[model samples]
Target: MRIVVPIKDNSGLESEVCEHFGRARYFVFIDVEDGKVKGSEVIEVPFKEHEPGDLPAFIKEHGGEVVLAYGMGRRAIAYFNTMGIEAITGASGRVKDLVEALLKGALKVDPEWRSKGDFGRHEF
Candidate 1:
């Protein structure tokens, strides 16, 4: 399976995960199989600035099966769901640590947060 994690830097996955999905500078795509990291790469977001849907579509093109983000807007979350890709938000800590937690089933997605709209700004 392929998982994408929004990262602040590509420094061996030890840096903190990005807090905002739309504003993340890079996304580290990791390929895993049987709870093991097979391969990975950092995909740069094009155009310096992008809409949420655009990033999701870029992820789709890269064979992403899941997304591990810190926080994301409701519209982007809905778009990911419509694409049948799993999105786990409200994540923090290092990218590699989060990935390990997910592989070990130690991480839990907060559905309440995911279902909320507009990062608590507007209603969906």
Candidate 2:
């Protein structure tokens, strides 16, 4: 499975998950198979400016099967869903750790915790 996580930097597996999905500086792509992470890569968000639905398509283009992030607006999540990508929000901590927890079926996402707003500024 290919899991994409919005991160704050280019630290690979050690990268901290970004608070806001659309505004994240980098995205970590984790490849997992047999319940183990095969490898990962970090890349910068490609566009200088984007609209509400752009990032989801970008993720899809890059073959993202799931999006693990701290916060993401409803519209973006809907877009991801339409594209068949699972948008798992309310995630935090190190990128690798989150992936591990997810694989272990321990990652919990509170559906009630919707992102406060959009355009890269989300309330906690």
Candidate 3:
């Protein structure tokens, strides 16, 4: 499975999870096999300006099956579900540690604070 994690920096696995998914500086795509991470890649969020569903669509286009985020709104979650992607929110800590927790089935999807789903234009 391919898991896409939103991060604050391009510090490889040591990168901390960003607070916002749509505005993260970088996105890490981790390839997992038998619950073990086989490989990974990081890329900048494609658009400096985000539309309602652009971020999720970009992740899906890059073969993401799941998304790990710190916070997401109802609309974003619904969009991800519609695209057959799982959105796991309220995440933090190093990316690798998060992945390890996931492998052990310990990375629980923390509850998200309700959002108005109103994000103004953001830059990369």
Candidate 4:
């Protein structure tokens, strides 16, 4: 499976998972099979700014099957869902650890996640 993780830096597997999915500076593309990681590639966010569907479209173009992020707004998650990509929000820690947890089925998805101010914002 191909997983996309929004990150703060280019540390590869050690990269810190960015708190906000839409505003992340970098992204790590990981390929896993048989419960083991096969390879990974990192890329910078393509645009200076983005709208609701851009990131999800980008992920689809790259053949991503899953998204791992600490937090994401409802619209973004909906977009991913529309594209047939699984958005696993409320994820944290290093990219490697998250991948391991995914393979182990240890990550949780909180359907009611929301920011402090309103349901419109994304707060990690």
Return the top candidate by lDDT.
Answer: 2
| Candidates sorted on lDDT, descending | 2, 4, 3, 1
What ranges in model 2 sit over 4 Å off? 110-112, 115-124
lDDT of 3 by residue, 52-106 (tens): 8888888999999988887776677899999999988777788999999988989
Q: State the displacement of the C-alpha of residue 91, model 3, in Å, after optimal TM-score superposition.
A: 1.2
Model 4 C-alpha lDDT versus the unseen true structure: 0.83
Q: Using alpha carbons, what is the TM-score of model 4? A: 0.88
Please rank every candidate by TM-score, starting with the best: 2, 3, 4, 1
Q: What C-alpha lDDT do the candidate models reach, one value each?
A: 0.79, 0.84, 0.82, 0.83
TM-score of each: 0.84, 0.89, 0.88, 0.88
Over 10-120, each residue of candidate 4 has an lDDT whose tens digit, in order, gives 888898887778778789999999989999999887787777788899899998999988778789889999899998877778889889988999865454545522434
Candidate 3: regions farther than 4 A off: 112-124
Q: Record all residue pairs in model 4 with backbone atoms less than 3 Å apart, i.e. clashing.
A: none
Q: Considering TM-score, which of the candidate structures 1 and 3 is the better prediction for this target?
A: 3
Which pairs of residues clash in candidate 1, taking residues 3 or more apart in a chain or in different chains? none
- Residue 4 miss distance in model 1 (angstroms): 0.2
- Give the per-residue lDDT digits (tens) of candidate 2, residues 13-118: 9989887897886898999999999988888888767787888888888889999997787789889989999999888898888999999999976554564545
